[model samples]
Target: MIEEIRIENLGVIAGARVELGAGLTAITGETGAGKTMLLTGLGLLLGGRADAAVVRAGATSASAEGVFLVEPGSPAAERALEAGAELDDGALTALRTVAAAGRSRAFLGGRTVPQSVLAELAEHLVTVHGQADQVRLRSAARQRSALDAFAGPTHGRLLEDYRAAWTERQRLTVELAELVDSAQERVREAELLRLGLVEVERVDPQPGEDLELAQEAERLGHAEDLRQAAQVAHDALMGTDDAQAPPGAAALTDLARRTLEVVARHDEALGALAGRLADVGYVLDDLAADLARYADEVQADPGRLAAVQDRRAALGTLTRAHGGTVDDVLAWASTAGLRLVELEQGDDRTAELRARLEDLTGDLQALADQISSGRAEAAERLGAAVTQELAGLAMASATFSVRLTPTPELGPWGAEDVEMLLAAHAGAPVLPLGQGASGGELSRVMLAIEVALATAPSSARPPTFVFDEVDAGVGGRAAVEVGRRLAELARGGAQVLVVTHLAQVAAFADRHVVVAKTEGDVVTTTDVRVVAGPERVAELARMLSGQEDSATALQHAAELLERSAVGR
Candidate 1:
């Protein structure tokens, strides 16, 4: 339930706040007094499209904020919490702002969020029905929904079952079509996988083999130069054929160690130096032996060089076709083999899909029949209840009907189409709601339907309902009946807010709010305030007559209020 709404800089409403409660609350005012601004504020708070034109003149922005008291585990509360909104004390604050530059923002429970978040919450929070909704009721799909809503829990369960079966049938049918349609594509893909696998298996590349082979090829291709360089380095490190050359480092280190050993008797530091020189001599000898072995091992093998190069080329070809390296190509081949098996199983899959499709179609047909039967039963009850409501609305001779006609093709909803038909008077041909009824008559018909649906024994209805001028063109006792039925809906545990001009309708409000406009030399502003006691009567008087001071109008307003109270 919406506990309150605060609006700023929106239309002629500079700033106003209205505290709302459960039951029927009515907002009324003189023409041009900006009563509609209340509903407009609600629309903004519910994430309606924002327009700069809604901003007051000279104002930079317009904003509307609402506080809703939600059930503990309701969908609305869950969604707000999911958006990181803090639902403090079970109250969620929804806000929307529209800048004069056409920018818009939305907030949920003080957290800034996308406008769609507010919209999703609004689905379960409120249901707004205005004069335009009467036109929407003309649609066949809308008619179907209305009938189902009025049909109560039994119809709801049937629809749930039907939709589930229908969805499965659709899924199977689409899969079957796709599998049949793309047969050639699947075949081509399988053949490509086969060829790739054959090439990879034939080459049989090993991981890291490419790098090792490349290194081997480089060494073999320069075998002569490598052997000569190795021999020269070995001879230089050990000794040369020239005897005049300074003794090799090994011989020099040995002579230094021998000199240090002779001086060790004179100085301790010289003894330590003698030991280090002896270790160096040992290392030089080991290096000389390793160099000689390396020089002997270096040899040229053209046959092995050719074989390594050819193997590298084959591996390179595989790498180029599949991946950047031999390992990557092997990985692709492994995955491709799995995919090839799946593709080759298409024939088996087709049989399986055909079997599943047959089972789903049978299930869908049965569910559709059940849905049609439920709707047929509901149509009768709905038509009777609405007709009874129409009688109270002063349309005694008019007949309302719900027509269920079967279609050749079953749909997600059902196999039948629904039409809400009306006959305005005796001897009048029954026509669809869109074509048969006048605006005023349509208003009454829609009101009747709403009242009937509101009285249904279902807990799935929206918490708040805003009806903007739903009583349009209605007057006399019919207007009073409309108000009474609205109050009835409220008594059914839903909060109803009605925007009305009729005194008869306003009289039935559990709480009355009046939009009062003040005109200044430069600007006009509207204020919304709750009216009670004598103030409400005076406002109703003003609605009944042009002047609130008129005694006759005042008396009529008083009696109307009294009558409405007694009726309640």
Candidate 2:
């Protein structure tokens, strides 16, 4: 239940705070008095699209904030938790803001959140029965939902369980269907993959082989260049000037030996330097010998280079298509090979998969059958109850029913569609609600369902009922009946709000707000005041006779309030 709403710089509403209460509360005003602004503020708080135009002309931004007294396990609380926001059942506040740039922000229970979450939370908090809302009832989807809601708890749960099975089977069906959808394409892909695997297997490229081969080919391609470089280095280490000498007996070795001998006769620092030089000389002698052997091995080989080049080029082509590295290509081939084996098992695997599909389908069909049976039983009870409510709403001779029929195809919602059918008077066959009822008749029909569904003990989540102009085009006994029923719904602890011009409707409200507007160059602003005692009677008199000052109108307003109290 919304406990209060505060608005600042929102359209024509400069700054207003209205404290709402439990039970039926009505917001009434003269035309152009900005009562609709209250509803507009609600829409934004509930994640409606924001625009700079909604901001008051002289103001920089607009803000809407409200306090919602919540139940412990209400859908609104669950939505808040789902959004990574806390739900303080101790006190829950829903807030929204629109900046001059038209960007919007939302908050739930003091935690900043996304607009969608705020909207979802709002869904269970309030139901606005505005003019546009009437159009929404036209869709087949909405019709189906309303009928299901009317069908009550057992029917709803059965549908849920049935749809769960239906959903899982559908996922399997889609996966299996993908395999069937591309049979010809699969054959082509499988053939290509098989060819790739065969090629890689026959050639058998090894990982890291490319680097090793490139190094080898570089030497083989420029053998003379390598040999010259190695020979120059070996000669320099052994002494290059007309001396035939083993490297161990060459000049660098002799110089180090002589230096060490001199240092032995000198100080400690010279001896350490000489020892380091001697170690370097010994290392060079070993390296020269290795260089000579390496020189002997280096030689050009055109045929071997061509074979390596051709194989490397072939592997390169495979790398471009399959993977950049040999290991990656190999892994890809391995996976493709496994899948090919399965796809190649052909009809056997297909038949096995199809059999599982058939089993799931059979289970879903059985659940659907049970769901259909349960829905039929629930729908009858719901239809009769709604029919009885309609009788009080001035359609005494109306008939109502739910049409739940099965189809060949199953959807996320299950196999059958539920529709509402109604007849406004006797001797008329029941037709779809949108077709069989007039504008005013439709309003009453909706109210009847809302009032009925509000008190349904099995409703998983029931929104506060709102009846807008339900008393429109109806009066006398019919209008009084509407008031009585609304009062009853309020008595049931469902927060009920109505917007009506009739005193009958206004008298039913436990609390009433009257909206007054002033005219100026820009159409000044609106004032909303909660009325009671004499103030309420005056407002009701204005509503009843359009002239509150008249004596008869005041008496009539008093009688209406008195009778409503007695009726309660």
TM-score of each: 0.87, 0.84
Off by over 4 Å in 1: 1-3, 19-23, 65-117, 161-176, 240-249, 490-494, 521-527, 530-538, 551-568
lDDT of 2 by residue, 446-512 (tens): 7777766666667654446655666666677777888888888888887777777778877988999
lDDT per residue for candidate 1 within 189-215, as digits (tens), equals 999999999999899989888888988
Q: Model 1 — which ten-residue stretch has the worst lDDT?
A: 518-527
lDDT (C-alpha, whole model) for all candidates? 0.87, 0.77
Residue 161 lDDT, candidate 2, scale 0-100? 81
What residue pairs are clashing in model 2? none
lDDT of model 1 at residue 221?
89
List per-candidate RMSD values in Å. Answer: 3.4, 4.2
